[model samples]
Target: MAQQVRGVIARAKGEPVRIETITVPDPGPGEAVVKVQACGVCHTDLHYREGGINDEFPFLLGHEAAGVVESVGDGVSEVAPGDFVILNWRAVCGQCRACRRGRSQYCFNTHNARQKMTLADGTELAPALGIGAFAEKTLVAAGQCTKVDPAASPAAAGLLGCGVMAGLGAAINTGGVTRGDSVAVIGCGGVGNAAVVGARLAGAAKIIAVDIDDRKLETARGLGATHSVNSRSTDPVEAVRELTGGFGADVVIDAVGRPETYEQAFYARDLAGTVVLVGVPTPEMRLDLPLLDVFGRGGALKSSWYGDCLPARDFPMLIDLYRQGRLDLDAFVTETIALDEVEKAFERMHHGDVLRSVVVF
Candidate 1:
């Protein structure tokens, strides 16, 4: 039977999201239905509503979520009903070239549910990142549901579903940050701070946080930054270099992906250092740099897609770390809100008022 659940939906572009009754269809082949317990309101959600991602109107917003699998479809073996899981946008298709090469994290053919959830009038709605979860229940590809330890609270555990994972993965995976390596992360938002924590987890000796806001910098400090630079008040490159003994860090991860910040990260690393870009940018945004500099940089300049995460592998590992108290995933939750609070949460995010405003169902 189809279940009608209260979900936050962006009925039209550039308009506020509303709590709409969305009809969740029964799972089809290789799909599963998740009973959402909590979902985080990410900047990407707002971007979808603003038409930044696509023209897919009437989007079912919200992605960063954790829930229990309520049902599964035919031929589903990756996940089963009643499993506690974290919802992910990246569900690697084993047949993709990337997966064929054993790099499932970069799977080119990742997918979502084959069936669509609809509005009361039967208009189909596009799920954000293919995992619309700002509701009591959501249907997703079975591979999109990564089972993890159920001990973690839904409010905190869900963060790993998106921004938090991106940040952490940028440092640990893309930057290859390790013990004794110095890392400077540009941006102190949710993703940025997660990179901070990721750096710390990887045993980075020095973690420098660069941001325009002081409060966010403070937040980053709590997340495990060894130094904080208010980029609005000073040159971030110089500050990062000064903190790293005037030689720059070993790895610089751009969490606030922009051309200027990319440049800052490019120059803020020591010789043979790595620069990782995890922050997303607008399409109109482009970067122009001296070709010589690109060649002159001794290490790789890389971008982290969904934090270069292999959900099945990384999610369970992270959850274990969270349970062991090594990774402080719970600290990332700034506020807990209900389903109707997404629009206001975006406002808070705009002003940098919260690290993360999670919707607790």
Candidate 2:
């Protein structure tokens, strides 16, 4: 039987999301239904509302979420009903070439619910990141649900589903931040601060945070940044170099995902250091660097997709760390609002006043 649930939806391009009665089908093969407990308001959700992601109208928004599985479909074993899990966008296909070669993090084909969710009148809805979660209940691939400690707060744990994971992965997995390394993260939003936290966890000697917002920089400091640079008043590359003994950081992460921030990350790394781009850039944004300079820079340039994280491995461990009070997951949750306030949360997120506004159901 199909279930009717209240959900936030973008009915048309650049339209405000509205609360609608969405029809969720019973899970099909390899799928499960999750009763969302908490969902974080992420910029990506707003991007979807603005039609920045694609021409997919009537998108079921929200991805960063944690919930309990209510039901499972045939052939689903990874997650069973009553399990507490964090929803992940990347449900790796083990048969893909990336998985066959032992690099499932780069899974060429990810999984999503085979069944389609729709409006009461039968308008098909596209779920954000294949796990539309800004609703009371959502359907997703069984693999998309990563089991975690049930004791953790849903608001905090759900963040691990997206931005937090992306930031930490940018530092630890993609940038390869290590003990005694000097790292600089550009853009101290949720992702940038996460990089700071990850660098600290990895024992980085110096973590420089660069951002135009003072409030975000202050938050970054609390997350373990050794120094904060306001790019609006300072040249971030030069500031980072100055903070790193006139050389440059061992790793520079571009969490802002803009061309200017990308350029700053490029020039702020040590000659042989790594530059990790963890930010999501728009389609029209271009990077024009001197070809000779690109050749002159002796470093690896990489992009992080979903922080290059393996959900099963990273989620539980991070939750355990949070449980131990070693990682500050609570720091990311600035405010908890209701589902109806998601649009307002997006405003706060855009204004840079809040790191995260989570919806508690």
Give per-model TM-scores. 0.99, 0.99
Poorest 10 consecutive residues by lDDT, candidate 2: 10-19
- The alpha-carbon deviation from the true structure for residue 294 of candidate 2, after best TM-score superposition, in angstroms, is 1.7
Model 1 lDDT tens row, 1-361: 9999999999788999999899999999999999999999999999999999999899999899999999999999987888999999999888978989999999999999999999999999999999999999999999999999888899888999999999999999888899899999999999999999999999999999999999999989988998999999999999988998989999999988789999999999998899999999999999998999888867888999999999999999999999998998888899999888889999999999998999998
232-269 per-residue lDDT for model 2 (tens digits): 99999999999988999999999989998888999999
* Model 2 regions more than 4 Å off: none
* Count of clashing pairs, candidate 2: 0
Regions of candidate 1 where Cα sits further than 4 Å from its true position: none
- Candidate topping lDDT: 2
lDDT of 2: 0.94
In candidate 1, what residue range of length 10 has the lowest lDDT sum? 293-302
